[model samples]
Target: MYQHEPPTEESPKEYKIKHARIYILLLIGQVLFPNKSGNTIHSKWTQFVVDLEDCGKLSWGFTVLANLYREMCKSVDIKVTEMSGCVLLLQAWAFTRMPIISLVAPLQAPYPYARRWCIKKLDYQNNPRHHLQGYRFRIDHMLQDQFIWRPYLGLAPQRHEDSLIWSSTTYIICFHIVEMHQADRVKLQFGHLQGIPEEPQCLVEHHKMTTIKARQKAYTTLYSDEQNCWLHRELFMLDGD
Candidate 1:
């Protein structure tokens, strides 16, 4: 909390505080509004502060982040629970010739297990662009030296055209991990990804098509197969719990 406003009414601080408070209240309104209909949180926050009369460029960054922090605080429900531990699931996509979807699942031990897979090519093509690629999902956990990217099956699969693999794989892996670890709660977080392509529709079309059923089947099959393989591998590692 940067306090630039003076406590005295005679000071310019009085005017600044009044105006700033008005904008802050509107921001709070947006955050608290159920079914937000306006611009995104970041957009509204930045615009509100920048649009304020006489507000300068230098303080904009700080104010935006700070107000966002305030809103997060307001929204978070501080609850007491019996479970003592929690895990965070971070998902991010990297755009390239063939995009990569990265997932890091939390284990009971001090470190986490990561997985990265390439998205399927939705459009049929004679000359396939890429086969397989290696992507390192780096996490700056605690110390700079303590980063782990293991179960390192580099991005490979490139067949199905629906392009639902990324979201499907994410759900499958997350469900398996949570069930295995029996985590109290999972904090789903997204990374700042850019230039990612839009999600593709179901591959089969024309005859009585339902996206839900097709995606459900794909997710289930993938999860079962992957889970079995993952568990078998884990059993061999003496370090795993």
Candidate 2:
């Protein structure tokens, strides 16, 4: 049983931007300290801030595995890379069953399993080949609930919430999924990245596409609800730039 609080009239349209700032910090950490390839083998602090909002946690496991499965499907167009991100995800799902997908309120625009992460521009002059070329090879993950959507930044690439529907309207953190359960833990185990769990389940290769599609459809319903409200209210951001 989940409980979501819809946006109130008083809620401003800047929350999405705030969420984007948090996401940027987390994504940076993932790239800098990816599994086995980076400086530190593991860091709890690094993990916590990744999702800040908690699905912001084991939900990533879901994302990794779901992504892996999604890529294999013929209908899915995007692709997740072959690296520790996927490996870590398998580890997490094996033990937790909590895919990052389950962390946000069911209202998020479901991540396109086939497509790569969304983005806007790049500072390639200072960045590496991966980001400059549209590759987010790293990610920071957390097991908390500290994020909400803000809709100030237009549908630029970096604004990774549910852009298709949000358009450039208000960006409020529409969903918050903090409570825990079996699925959450499973996603972590699936990733085989569990810190204490010593063993692996190796079940990442066996999920049904229906589960993946179900999650996506669910996300759509939730996102649509907000998008419709945005259209009616006409509460889009009004930047001076």
Candidate 3:
């Protein structure tokens, strides 16, 4: 009933450049350009986003979500559902650790169950809003939050109910949370991270390597898994149909 197929080739950089560029030009730039004037619904993707944003119905997205909201609305005791929706899965753990909504099979609620919270580790490590802190390239993107370090964009797995399924869309619109505030890609490369400003004026940098054991050991304590997780234990992302 199930099967696996190894990839014939993988060139993520090429794919992302093409895919991301086209999307910006067509969907966002065409429709929401600051100065450009388009009176009609030139792009279907824009229309869908508006419809979803306004209609608040299940007519827009192909997203996976936690069950907390639905359960709360129904007054049913249930856990949240994490990691649902989209087809392109971004396991940033292996890549640049960019907090993009890489797709995966829509995480769904199982049958005959009230709730279960399963997705955990992946959620905690990817801190949300770290793009502001400027660490899409840093393996450890923990940021100082008041007195604690939080995952740049917390990516904890969510809990869910016993009934959910995946439906197709003409296209899925995923909002990438990472964009360069600093232009000149060369300046933003991994090498320049050393010059990043520090808050308490004590943070230092170590030369990275294929295996930066000493560096990691030093930085590991910078974050707290218990206190400043990126994902909320009680409220998971409740993406809808």
Candidate 4:
């Protein structure tokens, strides 16, 4: 129940709190983890907003990243016409890690590192396909040293608790979608010496369960194995030097 007028000092405290929660929910759905239909938000996220106190403890960044990975994987199908998830995150990752292909100069911004690219003004390409081809060519020719594997080293907040799980090899659970966060596969990104990672986990069943028909099903029922894997993520973590 949102008010047309902005909450004033006279407004009830509960009403103000509810309004703030609503705003946050909208932001999460629209900007953070938007689906193919940009205008509508899935009802699954409403549970998180019901108790704002628990929000901080949640691995939201990991969830967003996992969703993006899942969406990208789905988009590989030639018949797939629409792509979902945060494309901005993808761009920011590319810009930070592959600076040679980045069109704009990096801004010296604080935490929430994606902001560094937000305020930039870039020249629009008349033909996007040609521009994409150029990016592909540049990426193909990129040297090993040219890639900034440890781009956010010393920039991430050391005190933040979430940083502990930055390199945790586990499944990132988002509702019915359970995607693997194979941190061991990208050990160099975490400033660790690359080693032969263990065999990848088979998640074919999880992928099959994340279809449109399965969206309404309970996440716990579908992803109990994934939840167990996440709980024991320390075992999966790479023992890199």
lDDT for every model?
A: 0.31, 0.35, 0.28, 0.76
TM-score of 4: 0.84
The order of the candidates by TM-score, greatest first, is: 4, 2, 1, 3
Model 2: per-residue Cα lDDT at residue 118 = 26
Cα-based TM-score, every candidate: 0.18, 0.19, 0.16, 0.84
lDDT string, candidate 1, 95-214, tens digits: 211122222222222212212222233332322234232233322122423322222233233422222211122211221121122111111111112233345322222112233444
Leading candidate by TM-score: 4
lDDT (C-alpha) at residue 172 in model 3:
18
Q: lDDT tens string, model 3, 1-241?
A: 1132322347565554444444444433332321123332334344444332353553222221211112122342256333222112223222223324221222433531211123332343334333634334343543433111122223333522211222111111112111111111222222222243333211122111113353454323433342232223223222231
lDDT of 4 by residue, 1-241 (tens): 3456778999998888788788989878988899887888888788888878897678788789878888888999999999889888888888788867765533576656777555665533421334778788878988989899866655546644344467888888777678889888889876689877788876777777645756576656766787898878777765548
In TM-score terms, candidate 2 sits at: 0.19
Error of 3 at 158 (Å): 8.5
Candidate 3's displacement at residue 96, Å, is: 17
Which ten contiguous residues of candidate 2 have the minimum total lDDT? 173-182
Please report the candidate that would top lDDT against the real structure. Answer: 4
